[model samples]
Target: MMNDTTFETLPGRRRSDVVYKTLLDRLYSGQYARFSRLPTERELTEEFDVSRPVIRNALAKLRDNGLIRSVQGSGSIVLYEHARGDDASAGQVSIGDFQKCFEFRVLVEQEAAFLAAKHCDRAALDVIRQNIDEVDRYVQRGEYRIGKSFDFHRAIAMASENPFIVQALDRVQDFIGFKIYIARSMSLPNPVERLALINGEHSAILSLIERREGEEARALMRSHIERARDLFLGCLPLEVVSDREGR
Candidate 1:
């Protein structure tokens, strides 16, 4: 139900990205079911009014994400269930690998938090606060909330007023969502506690920003992320070490 105006305002060379998202939305909403073949590339080109390369790029992304697969003689076949795999086993996350990724995030996000404190306008802070409130509301209702929680962090990144920081966090938001989902799926206790801690940390960072105390805010943010990383790792089963590389 997205309109042309929605697509026209997309930033960067992201027209193809808008197409990819539209296609993904359709697949997830059962516009195409499992094993249902999609339209031919030419047909999709006409439908989207995009070039073949654009359509191919969109479809190629779907394939890479395991949402669909293409056959030599046949068109792209829907693989809606492929993301979960046959056994419902998620891809493995090694302790070391997870730690590395977390460390990277810590380094990047701490700085982002500091910059946000220095640069964030009232409007940006309001956006983050609203996102936090939404997460709290959803959590209290026992509803699974991922996207909104991700948006909270994304808002903070944007508030940092650094284009690079914003872009880096945007890129990793998907991984952060996956990690949160893994924790939730495992029935980690104190999910709300974890979320609240993040919210509190954000608030503290905002306060520091209001006070123009960037360095202290940065340090606090680092500690907060590091602790969060540890907590996340603790929630996983000890067998995670053996499941490294998702094998």
Candidate 2:
């Protein structure tokens, strides 16, 4: 139950962007279950009080992002479902793919964190902080919102003042998102505990960035990613774990 005014008043953001972000947040928070139909375009138009074109554009963006699929008569179906115990279905990513994605993040995001520590302005810091707050709120409600975690990392990349870094991250976002889903689902016993661990690492990184400690931020970022990689890899289903070892 989000207040309409929340997206309505985001300064300097387009209407479509607002709609996309809001819907993305909802999808990641499990508000829209997998295979569940979303509100119709007309319904969304009425709810947001925007033009039909605007709603269509937002829906199109969601489809492009792999978060939803459009059925001819059924409207949009949310695709971000909870990961079951099946490795093949848990994001369709292999252990090697997970390792590669994490390795890429370590290479790019560590430098991004270091640069963000040196270059992050107040506004950028606020955006990252807001993302963390959103994650905390969702965790409190027993929901795992992967979008907030992605947003937090992207904001830090933007704060680094490197468009290429942002682009690099964005290009891999879908795969990274799937990886995150698997990790959150399999890494720990309690969802709250796993999310708290992630949120704590994010907060620590943010603190280091704010304190302008570039080296410390970089080191911590590496450790944070590595820890998550190891945890998820260890907790993967036994068959997949065996595959990785056999390779």
Please give the CA lDDT of all the candidate structures.
0.66, 0.75
Local lDDT at 157 for model 1:
85
Q: State the number of backbone clashes in model 1.
A: 1
What does candidate 2's lDDT look like per residue over 53-118, in tens digits?
A: 778877775775467889998999887664545555353446677677889989999999999999
Task: Predict model 1's lDDT versus the native.
Answer: 0.66
- How high a TM-score does candidate 2 get? 0.62
> Whole-model lDDT, candidate 2?
0.75
In model 1, where do residues sit more than 4 Å from their true spots? 1-90, 139-147, 176-186, 238-247
Which residue pairs in candidate 2 have backbone atoms (N, alpha carbon, C) closer than 3 angstroms, thus clashing? none
* Superposition TM-score, candidate 1 onto the true structure: 0.57
